[model samples]
Target: MKLHFKIEAEKATSDIDVTIDNLVVAGWAGRDHAAIEHHIEELAALGVPRPSAVPLFYRVSESLALQGQRIQVVGAETSGEVETFVFSAGGILYVSLASDHTDRKLETTGVALSKQICAKPIAATAWPFAEVADHWDSLIIRAYIVEGGSKVLYQEGPLSSLRTPQELISGYTDGAAKLPDGTGMICGTVGAIGGIRPSSNFTLELHDPILNRSIHHSYAIEVLPEVA
Candidate 1:
């Protein structure tokens, strides 16, 4: 399926000349190099192995990515917040919010398989990279999980919590493979408050207070019937 996104360009120009083939997720991309252990400890509780190094890379099936208001999963134990970067074929950059929705059960067996088993949800709205480049560190990302008919803060932090986009892109590419046009990368995320847990509905946003604009996306998780 071709994923189309609304571009908020710096200038009043309409452009839609990009196709995405590679969708990559950069994990352990945090700036607090020392805190990586803490984040690892958090996931290790769920049987996820500690990464061999920082900035671990994983490729999810671009065919499984979704941007609508609702997404269906077989069995997802929890979701995490992340800032998504979209690279245009022209080298222009855009940013949005997304949830690396993962199945905790499968994660224990294999991280890549767990990531693939669930559809990656992203926001339809995106902001031009130039708009917030000067104050990129000030950008904030927050998420809430609907629990017992009320929304509770699941994760919250600034974009600076993780490695900058430049660093992550460089690490992922290693100066070898340039991020091709229409490449979409879901950058790593911060820790979850109150510990990671499951929820039926998940909402998230990428807020740039400097520009006074934000990209928001929310989706409900519907479990499919299991053959017993």
Candidate 2:
């Protein structure tokens, strides 16, 4: 999958088209073990099974990466969680935002299958990893969902809550300092504010307090009727 993104750096802003050959979603990646277990319990309440291991990596199709304003799903039991997206291209790493939109109902059957069935929406803009390497933990990720015709905060937390990009890349690549070129990974997410639930629209944001800038993206969900 080819994605066009604007690279925002301290010295320059350039447009780069990245070709992603591999896409992986990292789950249960919280820095704190207790927090990770809390998230597992949160999902368990909804019938989702606990993962066999901590920080599990689920390989997904690169074609599922999307940069559109809308998406379609099979039912109303799907929801979105904001996550930090890291991409490697031309030997350079970039940080961005992505929503791990998932099917809750199908999630009970299989987490990987539920993820594969939904489109992963990502922001079209990215920041160079080197630019924010010093204060990576301060960066915040948040999401808002349209609830009862009003936009409400769904999830919010600092990147520190989850594992760092370097940590995740190393974990994924078996101690490699960086991911292979033409690869992307969606890091783990924070817990939902009011619990996970389906909504017609979902918005994601990655805020850099030190830089005073944010990358924002929103996508509307269209639920298609199920015929069985």
Candidate 3:
């Protein structure tokens, strides 16, 4: 074994998304951590499940005072084990094959992958990134984990109906999920030869099952834990 100073370095990887019954909510400014924590306690007293699949949310957004100001709120209803999302508030609820959402990724100039991921960031000036969410699907994310974060993408596509609760979990049938290149895919297969069987692809078929619902997302993502 080769040893320098006995220090081991880990490669950057973006991988895996898991379902959580509870999620910490944050806003443009900051998350009301204390308020949300208290709410969690209240839900616990009310016998809310330890983990929830269909989330019911109550929240307010910009322009509360002005007349016609809107609020964003939504909930999920379950009957006979079938669950659906009900979004209302801010006038309507909608779902789609895709929607616009913002997030961060890492980019560098010297490397090939970085060059592609940060294509525009390289030019002196360029059209603002058009398809950003797709970046989460293809870009290497762990690069930012050690040093910093990068704001690089936005996603937009046909949005479903407004004024009605749209379904985000329904309609999908089956497909192979193409994860980003550096996705931290665990649980690879093994051959009878007992060698490393590697793959970054997942075969998914949607049914009325919890595993299917949990794996379906409007967007693709791979995330890492934070430093303490």
**Best candidate per lDDT, number?**
2
Off by over 4 Å in 3: 1-52, 55-57, 63-129, 138-228
Report the lDDT tens digits of candidate 3 across residue range 1-228: 110111111232222222212211111110233433443443344344232322222121211111111111111110000011211112222111101111112111111221122101000110111222223122111100011243221211111111111111121112323222211111100011111111111111112121112112121122223435
Q: What is the C-alpha RMSD of each candidate to the true structure, in Å?
A: 2.0, 0.7, 22.6
Which candidate tops TM-score? 2
Query: What lDDT, from 0 to 1, does candidate 2 have?
Result: 0.94
Using Cα atoms with residue i matched to residue i, what is each candidate's TM-score against the true structure? 0.92, 0.99, 0.15
User: How displaced is residue 26 in candidate 2, in Å?
Assistant: 0.4
lDDT by residue for model 1 over 28-80, one digit each (tens)? 88888666777788899989997878888898888766778777777546565
Task: Give each model's whole-structure lDDT.
Answer: 0.76, 0.94, 0.17
Model 3 clashing residue pairs (backbone): 21-52, 132-153, 132-154
lDDT, ranked from best to worst: 2, 1, 3
Off by over 4 Å in 1: 10-17, 176-178
Error of 1 at 38 (Å): 2.2
Please give, for residues 34-93, the per-residue lDDT of candidate 2 as tens digits: 889889999999999999998999999999999999999997899999999999888889
Cα displacement (angstroms), candidate 1, residue 135, comes to 0.9
